[model samples]
Target chain A: MKKLLVLSAFAAMLASGTALADTSGKKIAFSNNYAGNSWRQAMLDSYGIVTKKAVEDKIVAAADVFTTADKEVPTQAAQVQNLILQGYDAIVINAASPDALNGAIKQACDAGIVVVSFDGIVTEPCAYRVVVDFKDMGKQEVEQMAKFQPKGGNLLEIRGLAGTSIDDAIHAGILEGVAAHPEFKIVGSVTGDWDQTTAQKAVATILPSLPDVVGIVDQGGDGYGAAQAFAAANKPRPTIIMGNRQDELKWWKEQKEKDGYKTWSASIAPGVSTLAFWVAQQVLDGRKDIPHDLLVPYLAFTQDDFEAALPKIKEGGVATHEYTQEEAIAAIKANIK
Target chain B: MTAIAPGTLPKSSPRGNAARARLLRGLLPALSLALVLIAIAWLNPRAISYFGFNLMLNLAIPIALATIAQMFVIAGNELDLSIGTFVGFVGCVTATWLRDAPLLGIAVLLGSIGAYALLGALIHLRNLPSIVVTLGMSFVWQGLAILILPKPGGKAPDWLLAIMSFKPPYVPFPIMAALIIAAVVHFGLMRTSYGVILRGSGGNAAALRRAGWSLLKTKIVLFALTGLFGVLSGMALIGITTSADANIGNGYTLLSIAGVILGGGEFVGGRVSPIGAVIGALTLALAASPLLTFMHIPPDWQVAANGAILIIVLAARVLISRRER
Candidate 1:
């Protein structure tokens, strides 16, 4: 027993020595919810480049990445567990669901692994919530539409996964925007799971019923599908459709060549994977001063803005680390509430 | 159960053999869809408009196709869990690689179908139970889909998009194609020698082996047809969605099985119809529309309702079959 205790004591001492390694060099692991979509894939690719560049330039000592292409909660949670087991000082997460991921976040925080959530917000204090100002996002879409429809008109709000924080936040934002415009009558709303098919079909079905409906406040991917639905019906398209998907901007431009591209505009978006990285950095460096929440910058886009952003985004990749650690911290502090 | 050649029951008696086929062919499917529709109407009739009707039919296409694909394999006494992931993978790849080139888009689809068919056949030839292989293959296909697209964004042309959102006055193109496939598959299974041999193989593989026919060959053909349906469905959805997303075919896995049984087909094997699958698929779509309209039900509840409907329909079919026995 004494021999075993001595062995265990030696192991603990070694672990302590490694943890306090003076290089201020610690491994930061970026865990994701699958790089399955073009936007997600692009985001991950950008994360790779930015994390690598930052590490190479001595911004951080070492970096690691883990992904769950299945995008399931358990798989992503396992990735976090594995990162924790590997003794990463801090972990960044693009949680599939805030509630479902709470246990993992708690485990990491309890174990002294700082947890920062981006894109998807976890309600618990353990998370430093970094998200887009989705309410502003919703209000922006309406305001953009207000430019076209000076008189409030009938609207359809195509939503994402129901009951999810991301969808709810965005939906709440859209409603707040709608509150300002009493003239805008909400014709109908449906959950597309943020899928293109459901969005397209929902809009198409609703279109024949509501011919007077002038616009739709879409949740990202659904915007493109809604646009197609409008085109299919051979009706004069809506004056305003808000698309928050950046990767799709390129496709919108290509489509605009034949059809007038002015049919839709994007509010703003935070890169999920990029947010995960920044959150990891923040947690690892022990900057608890950051407020409970932060908003990733958003860029509302027009056809011309898409034309400009497409090359920069596609070439540089989404989440291309425009802000350095100091700049990112400042930005977070500036927006934190 | 019907594998025996009865003394008085006669060989391949339509009552003993064709009864299951007939139920799935016309009667059971039509009844289930009608009952579900009636229930939905009672729950909420406002969702029964022409637009809602179109939405239901459109929603059913992909699920129906996957169900029919599953039916082909299950009917042959095998299983293919990979078909869902296959559709997702092929759908994304076809949409991504040939988003602009319509001809190549179609060609890529055909090639994927061909590849899956060949792969299925190879798996069967290696003496592997398809369920195990297909389970692993589903993961592989899903992973590939992610690797290929990573994010759910891409541009499929507007012309293709038009077909999905616009259903004609006389007949919807999707429904028409579905009808044609149904008729072709139905007649091919009932009238052709190929059909008899394949159905017979499912009933008594050892007996068919004694008769000097290759069950392997027939099963391979079934796999091929299943792959073909997935390809067609993927292409159709590409038009509807106008963008290829990696998770486009999610929930299609279990939903396909639910559709098959609700369409009055059995899990054991033998007898499935493309028409029955369409009815089955549409039944599922309409099942939830009313809840969306009036019941203020969530999709999770609707999914539960679908499962319940499927169970009741399948149980009733089993009872009727037993009573006939």
Candidate 2:
């Protein structure tokens, strides 16, 4: 029975391989807004690796990436228009503004182009969104902290970039978590802008005024900085939530070996750009049943599994998972219901 | 946009040399514009079409407006470091108040312009550096913008949306808007008598004072004009983007300065050309990112390439003006 099931799975794989051939002559473009940080760099790297193989395998004719020099909404909007004019079959975007790019995105939809946005997803109804449950991840951070600290006290919240949807969602989730677990009290909050340096500076500034006794909750790209701030201040260390960055994980490993420090880490994988790329390809391949919004799980690590994943992540890069076409289809299937 | 002698061209000087210098100065801006246009067309012939321009230059309208705003300050031999944030503040207002409450929005916008006039009066009376005053105002405007809209979501007014997306038959909206802006500003600040007074204040304030022109009024008017155009720029930006972010217009500060310089406007002496400034704004709008896109430059090098393009064009302008000297 096992042999028969394996033979049938092989046949199903063969069938999907033939189905992928329909998009062999089409081209897709990735329109990225910014690449100033490690997360975005890893995103582009994963996209390059995945799309290079896709092109080599003739899954698509070409997959090119275009990143705007400035992190301005209008610049990225103009880029989408250019991609439309260039006649790409589809465009995958990590947008600058969720709604500011809607004009350009609507123009793309009017021109009959498929647009799939991830990470910094757009609100345009015509576009496909591949989102990770950031709120859940935020809630999970506190839950994990509960497991380690057992007795929660004051918490320092390091927020992401100001005026971003992801930042708001994660903040809301953390607030909800604290409400449910009344022991965790958020004493102070600082805007980190999702950068290590910025987070360090912000935490350093607020540390002098706050009573942070137990743990630190933060949006990704900021954990290491908070730890650094705590170290520089010569304060007792807290159970800080990590953001799946290599440096954060590396620091966690060091602390774990020294004193058995426990924590949790989670972030939307940067390689989600590749998943967005695959979604665009699927849409271009005449898949009408795909939902407009596909929610995938965030990349996360705990004390037991984080060390194993740390070495695989590039130096100064975030932990990431490049999505294959099968995994993308599975994600789509899961979202369908 | 024709080459017009900017201001009192030294009536007693070597007349031929003065005329030649003025002509070269006027032509330098157009030359830079033409070089960028030709480079774009050469890189990708497809970008020369009407649709191509509409898409490529979609954001140029606001940029040109912002440049014109900067030109007014430069014309008075002063600078506005706050215009960018001011525009962002205006954009936040347009996206929220302008859409929800029209009368309040209009009042607030006009009030802000009045505030600018007041700033001008204060700067003139106190003998404060325009640079320092405007620099401080930049933070004030940014804070106000964030207060109005903490997040990056607001709808552009329907009328604004309709006006911005309007497609004229032969010419693109951005091009049409640029021409109108250039023509109207050129007439107002170049041919009119009061415009001469304004420029004269920058050229020779003592002579203007002796001539019985109120330098205070000119400064106020210049600043109010900057406020007016900045509001328009912010509104146009939101109309195009269909939403607002508090940081949306932050880039305009440097870009506006660059546009004014690229358009052959001088830092002091009221040596500014409205038509040339408009052309310069267009040149920058095109060169900022479109040229790099057409050139297929790598993303990693695009910012550096943008700087190189700016340097090359400005260098050519300097070289041309030098030849006339």
Candidate 3:
């Protein structure tokens, strides 16, 4: 009876070995913070493309997906737990909140699941910290302001949400760059929190009091509202400004065409889809056994550079609307850090 | 609604009688303000000084504007979870566009009232319930904000920040602003035909409509005023924080609602009192201020506290109404 049982076990192993023996037979799990937003949805779509090819080509055993509805911290935290319970080798996480997600992240690592964060990073030395260096973006914006201002001008800096590590770190980087330039005096700043109407109201009231404002450093969409506010006041536009969205590029172009010139320069950061590919790959690789942290590099762009960056953006998967998964992932991995 | 009946000035009452009632009504809000002042003084002895008093006034100005903005919406049975978004967007827009143009920044801030009023009117005319619409609008605007300033770093107009942040002793700008808005609001909705119509529409739109009134117009105007006033509050807040960041007005939404409920404003809508709204806003500001200084509760509890206060205040109002009934 014992001999027969041993023989039967070997037979079962051989049967399963046909599929699992492939060098790329490792399975991966991708967990995202939110599917409701365009950025997150773009990432999830990229993951599907990348994972599908990997599985069909016999490179990956399987790929699972986990995503939340909003920037809900605990909900994303629980997603990590579900991935862990399923014995997933790795997970690409887009944490909704920093610091708040540490415990769950630590839990995923304890269970030997490789974790890689993209876009918004977890401050902890998790398996990998993948992000577009916000601080670097800040530095680039200040440096551009320096160029725009042969004689230092007043820079009214607008920030993202406060308290989040993203906002905190980016400001740190911007100040470091801006402080060195004595000519670029910071007039004042307030948290705009990324709303068009709210920012419009704020600009309307403040524009009356702060004349000679030359530069504006802020998020992309709200910049449109700020520009609108300035137009409403019948004031000439500011000379130096920084923004970071591709869609808003259209708005800038429209402004230029309609009004002869524009002041928007974007220090483009790779979106969340880049995160999806790497995180998916890390899981497929054997890196699942030990936790590792990684950071994705961000690129700065000028008026001349933006047109060049657009092609790369166009090549990136469902987000770009033009590239196949294999082609886009290969290009992104090859071109960027 | 019954609260209005008892407060009606008596036709037969002599001058002193009216004065005494006015004094009592006025004193309640004043007392609430004094208690908060006393608490601040007791907590930090140095906080009572000339500069300290000025500081409190400076602090009060932003919150007071916010409270009044919140009061109008609540009085008409609406909610604005968007003021937080409003403050953030308004502050950033002002900082980014008018950091150098002091005069223009002020104009932009005032002009936004029309902008907000129009936007507020659109929200009503679109034929949807306000709470959900405003909440969705907040998210959309917040997303728009990220798109605008994706990362943090912007400057506010100096004069704008100074105007919001600085206050001399014996003169409270936020109080003055709120009272002025309140008086205008009070008169607009009371002494004038328009005010009476607004009140009547708020209390019973069906009856108002049956009487050949445009309840729809009244609702839209009330909300527009509510938004305008709320944006007015955002103007002060834009100055106080003094930087443009996406999350600047994050917590103001719930805080605004709480101010209305705390000052004895009702939740079912249509009951507004300038004096009560002022007291409520002060009460909320005072409660929130104390928590920041003296407590070690969870950071998220601030939001919970606002919601809890609303419930408690509503319950108290219910019980009081029951006793009176």
Candidate 4:
């Protein structure tokens, strides 16, 4: 009886291997670090929508999503190892830290799985990254500010979370952009923590002390709050270079209609996850020309663009530009060197 | 015969100098709060205004509530490491189910409090360390919070928001809320008849047991009170933020513990102050960010500076307390 049970177990393993080889469709999984924010929720939503369509179109066999709350690297590393053992064709990740997941990512690569990291990306050479050039986003924001204030004045730079790589990159890019215009003096800066309530309080506290600020440059997610702070303080509204959240866009649209306000906004859309999904799909479909690092562009909004996007936004929903599969493919094709 | 000797005071009279020292020690928390307030006002004159007080103390209500909750657990000689995450869990429930299905939400919250009571009973019966149990329960609460909300986008109830945003003519909302919390908690935990028995259980468990009071009952009551205040703290937090997240209340644990200690709460003694706890919470809220911001400290050093301020004030408290002994 023992010999028969061992022979049956071996036979079952062989049968499962044959079944896996026979399936034509590819299985993909998303290894998400933190699902505690609206941005992450939106990303997961887009993934759900796109993956559903992919499954219906017979482009993918199955898609699975796993999220960890603590944003700890070990939890995500263990998750990746589990995904590897489950025989996933590809894994897309929003890593907690850049270097902590390298070992697990290397293991996945050795298992012949395609790995795509986006948003908070991993730095492992084996992993393909899909992200916006945050530094350039910062530079473009300052340039847009320059358009509003041609003769530069005091620019209140509201930063994101302190000590974060994205914060450092964006601030560095803003300084680089301001280097050309010596008159654009940064009067004061505060970390808004990339949250609305925190930003509003920080701005409210600092507004009384700052000199007549002519413009504002903020890392996205705090523009609406900053505007509210200025209004609450009864100060004349400065040209707040907006981020692409729905609330900010709605406020911007209202200001344009009521006061003829003119300011540009730009953001990396949460739908970028869909792009990462398509890139993973492309790689799985034997696309060899994909680059290791793909820089997705931010959706830059002028007054007209905001006007167009305003009608599409639902109540309490974020304003996000959809990244189509064709555009994802074209971006991949364009960036190959 | 010794009474005939005049012009000399009794050196062993415990009521003379030690009484004054004890009074000073009792006033330490309030003194620290006043110093912080004065420093803030001197640095930024605008901080003295009614609007400034409202803004600076906007988030104090939740901290005060959480400190009161921690005080309950400390009253029973137990530390609740899970109170922070428990508040987060309650916040998530308030944002989602409490808004959608009011009855179900109420049931779930009551069930959680009951779970706390059961944990107390288990700790008493099994002779388990409360720190270990509560620390383990913290992850459980965190997981349950995530399961309920999944993300950070739930609107607080309109009524709660209204109450939190209430601006009286003379006093700010936070100050009013703090007064009410202090009064209610002080009455329930310090002045009531059964309160003495509950405190005695922590101060001297063996004696209380010998005196016909059940230790298990006191532990359950104390833990239940903690659950009750933790729920209030979470609801208050959501009311201020206008949204909910699983990790929003993560910082409350240490803040609550610090507030209790700053308010003259000891770990093993049933000595805690409801009024001083609120004041300590207010001091921490002010010193957490606004003080550093007013001082023009860089954001990178603000956390460290906040710790330094806490250490300084707490050291002063220690010195005064030592002198009293």
Candidate 5:
């Protein structure tokens, strides 16, 4: 009779624990579009790093990640639908296309799930966005170029993937920046495809025809490649605006030591995914003040700053800054309606 | 050689002129290659130099190798829609296992080729469409590539990089590599006695089978050859890029098919040429980017312009080919 009474009490406790799991924490899923590039790899890695802590701290009940190879919109849409059906409390997406996943996102929204999109974002109204202002990046880069070349000269623009929204916005901002400095002449533009080898090849091909270029404005990921092209031709190194890739930083450090070269580097940190994770946690914690669209600033570093941070980055890894959980919560609170 | 009698000399007729037109039709790919070269030279005279060619054609070695691989399948009247992903899989192997552990890499790559042979046999035995089978295999290969290297971070083996970077005097490495690929494949496929049987299998499989040649063996051999060249192409690509990505060769499937067709190959016919295929690859590579970039066209329109060039060249070939009839 005593054993039976003990068993009944244990079963009641188990039932209560099960009932409390829902209110204790929320289940989250990360949907990634492509895992082919280093930047994406780093972003995904950051998610793993942050979610482990979040899970241990009871900020999230469970976290899962999925990636598609071809960046097909249909595949990602299906993935989001599966996440919703799996009863996830929130879904974080680096979307393949801006508008293709809206219907699925809306269905999730109707289910009362929180959705946050970052980097390559979705266009769904229900989804909150965490993005860096790429136009400002372009404008800032050109302004830096102007400072480097006080006596305005020809500028070669090494652009990112053609026809991408980010590419268009950055180019527009660059044009705006150039308009402010009439002395800077836009000589030519070429798509680097956001790859080092491709950028190198394109720059090498175009190098023969151009006049003396005083400065170069390029999207992040191709700065080292452009430098290599100039080196190959044995031409005087132009003042290249640096991208915050580790390889670029290493090269810049070497140049600074060897020739006292000076340059600035700036980019959207790969750790922005961590910020997205923290924001999701805050929103799930009943922080109703979070803004719909959160604009994160780009991480900018001078040559000395890069040298100081160089040791922190691993070989073959990208250069990025940390976004602490406290800072993410603070920012959201400040921006809340 | 039997000598024609002086009194029985044939008169010059329209048939002779028709024969000449057919001969010219066969030379259309070569002519088009020359035309493209001339156009490139006209746009940028310095591009015709040795250093310029080296830089311009640095990436052509892989394309040429891929075209040859596609040619092997086309010679058997079978297309490989999986060659691109197959190359990516091979590239992943080369950049990771092949660089880190040489023996295991060789075994895996050889095993992959064997798998290709089996795939060819299976398609033949089941009477499956090559297109459907290869398309299915494309996904499998891509999945395997991702499994091997989840991200784009593997380094190409040092020896392969060394070979790719070798700079010979006067002749560019790419041009030399192209010539060597063409000549070797031509000799292997066109000059050997067994090669005739291979071509015969495509032209008339029933006749070949009647003569005791195994259709299954020919199919397997053709696919294995394709696997061999695809591996070479992948390795060469990594050697140049010095890294690997799972989707690096995604564009190669259509490019290989286009190369084969543009090189005077037919969809169902046994007609194909190694030299022409390489030239076609070179032409397509030139037209794809360098030509348009040199023309000062915007990047957004370059892809469309490339299609236009291909259409115009193919149309010119068709116009000349019509005269053969």
Candidate 6:
């Protein structure tokens, strides 16, 4: 019995000696709800790039990704259950709904699997959330607009998907920003659903009735569409806030070159999926100090630097940064307090 | 117009051939479901167990309910495009009003069913296209859903959550629920006499009218049943998800229609099977994601693969049905 105790003590000492927890044998699964957009496509790509390296280096055993074909809550809930059944050590998810998948997520947590959610993060208390401060992003949109448009005239608001938590957060932030800066009056608002075509169509439909608009504050992915709507209507272009998409940056650059048009671009990097993966890996490694909710900074670009970053973005993809394990650890440390 | 009653066999075909065709038609949906189940079991043997079924079929109850709702509309020779949005509206109510103010929620739901009856009456009295009317009503339901639950955060009632999570001994809740849904809807729409009249309205409205039956009443009854099932579907979905989103059931429009079609229902004719529809919903809910995941198909191809699976199963159904013709 003493010999067995000594052996166990030695094993414990060996584990502490390594500094980093041994997750080399652990298997991770990524359950992504939707991949229909460029942003989601880039997220998957970033995840694939990072996890493939992690696997080859033996940082983890297997990292498989499962994406639902449709954006249904039940579909994603079912997918999460399947991942639990698959015996994955950890699951990283981009949830379909904030509250809908709690039932499945609770079951996964009960089974002792580490679940990390990002972007469309879950509201389940057991799951770890890696989310961008979308509300802050919305406030910053107006703050940045104040820089370019000193005489804030009538502003139009283009919103994201109506029922999403992110949309509500951003919309609330924008309202707060507008309240702080009384110079800007939101004369018109329309739901863009965060798609360029949908935003363009929505804006075109509502622009005819509105008076002169000097600025447009929007959640990301709809800025370029707003610009196109103004152009198509032959109305004077407004200082539109851009989401960090290649086309939005390119359009901003063209407008800059033509007439010194300046606007701010910001979005949650699609590569946050990689950060989510690393968070799951860290939790599976038995890190105790990590918080359930981790707030990560959003990626933003100003007029001076957006042109330089424009070439780095793929033709139809959003600007994203893939995080390494070290960076993910640092982020976790930053969020600890 | 020559009207062929639902129960009495047509004079055109022999009794044996008709029986064979009827049997084949009845068996086609089950065949499709079995094929999917077998494929799933083959791909991942672990997915066949009780836990596997519990997890896999978790969403099938709501889908089966939604498919039954669509079936009700189709039984009246009318299409309901608004059912998906109506479900979303009902989900919002379930998550909010039903959880908070139970009586008000029940009243609202019953009133919504009355609204559906009114829509049916309007369509009948005005001789309007069901397609156009329901399509327009889809927007109305969506708007109402958004107004009720502007954001996707709501708590499911504890009782509902408990009922949904109930685990029966030796059988998963979802499978048990699917069986109950199938048996109940089949008995209501297939075995009963009034149900035959409802099916006949779709087969030959003119004949039913000539026979002294009120076509308006049948249409209203069918639509009201659609509303009832849609509410059940919405509540079931919320009971599973534990919350509500305004766009939650938006995909059900196509899914429910596909479920009915896959279950051997025709667009123009009053041909529908409640048991077959529940099976078809199960097949679709399985084929929609689980089969693709088990196959290890990459994310890029999963969407296309999903469409391909639908095509293959539906094509098989079509070929079998053609033999019946």
Of the candidates shown, which would achieve the greatest TM-score relative to the real structure?
Answer: 2
Correct interface contacts retained, every candidate: 0.00, 0.51, 0.00, 0.00, 0.00, 0.66
How many collisions between residues are there in candidate 2? 0
lDDT of 6 by residue, A187-295 (tens): 9999999899999999999999999999999988998999999999999988999999889999999889998998899999999999999999888777788899999
DockQ of each: 0.02, 0.54, 0.02, 0.02, 0.02, 0.61
Q: Candidate 3: where is the Cα deviation over 4 Å?
A: A1-23, A124-126, A195-198, A240-242, A255-264, A267-272, A287-291, A308-337, B1-325
> If scored against the real structure, what TM-score would every candidate get?
0.49, 0.93, 0.45, 0.52, 0.52, 0.89
- TM-score between model 5 and native: 0.52
* Error at B257, model 2, angstroms: 1.5
Arranged by lDDT with the best first, the candidates are 6, 2, 4, 5, 1, 3
Which of the predicted structures, 1 or 5, would earn the higher lDDT when compared with the native? 5
Best by DockQ: 6
Worst-scoring 10-residue span by lDDT in model 5 chain A = A15-24
Global lDDT of each candidate: 0.66, 0.89, 0.59, 0.81, 0.80, 0.90
> Which ranges in model 1 have alpha carbons more than 4 Å from their true place?
A1-337, B1-26, B101-108, B170-177, B288-293, B298-307, B322-325
Poorly placed runs, candidate 5 (over 4 Å): A1-337, B1-14
Question: Model 5 over residues B38-135: C-alpha lDDT tens digits?
Answer: 87788777678775676567667888899999998899899999998988899889989999999999999999989989988998899999999999
Give Cα distance to truth, residue A226, candidate 5, Å: 40
Q: Every prediction's TM-score for the first chain?
A: 0.82, 0.94, 0.76, 0.90, 0.91, 0.94
Per-residue lDDT over A1-337 for candidate 3, one digit per residue giving the tens place of the 0 to 100 score: 9999999999897556433534364657666655543344455555566567767876667776554433544335545554554556777766665444554566678867667776666655655765556777677677777776668778776776666666676788779877878778777675666555566677777777785778887643356567777889998888635354454454555656676554546532434454455445644443233234444454445565455544444322111322343443443445344
Task: Please give the C-alpha DockQ score of model 4.
Answer: 0.02
- Residue B132, model 6: lDDT of 100
Q: Please state the CAPRI-style docking class of candidate 5.
A: incorrect
Could you give the candidate ranking by TM-score, starting with the highest?
2, 6, 4, 5, 1, 3
Please identify model 2 stretches exceeding 4 Å from their true place.
A1-18, B1-21
Docking verdict class for candidate 2:
medium
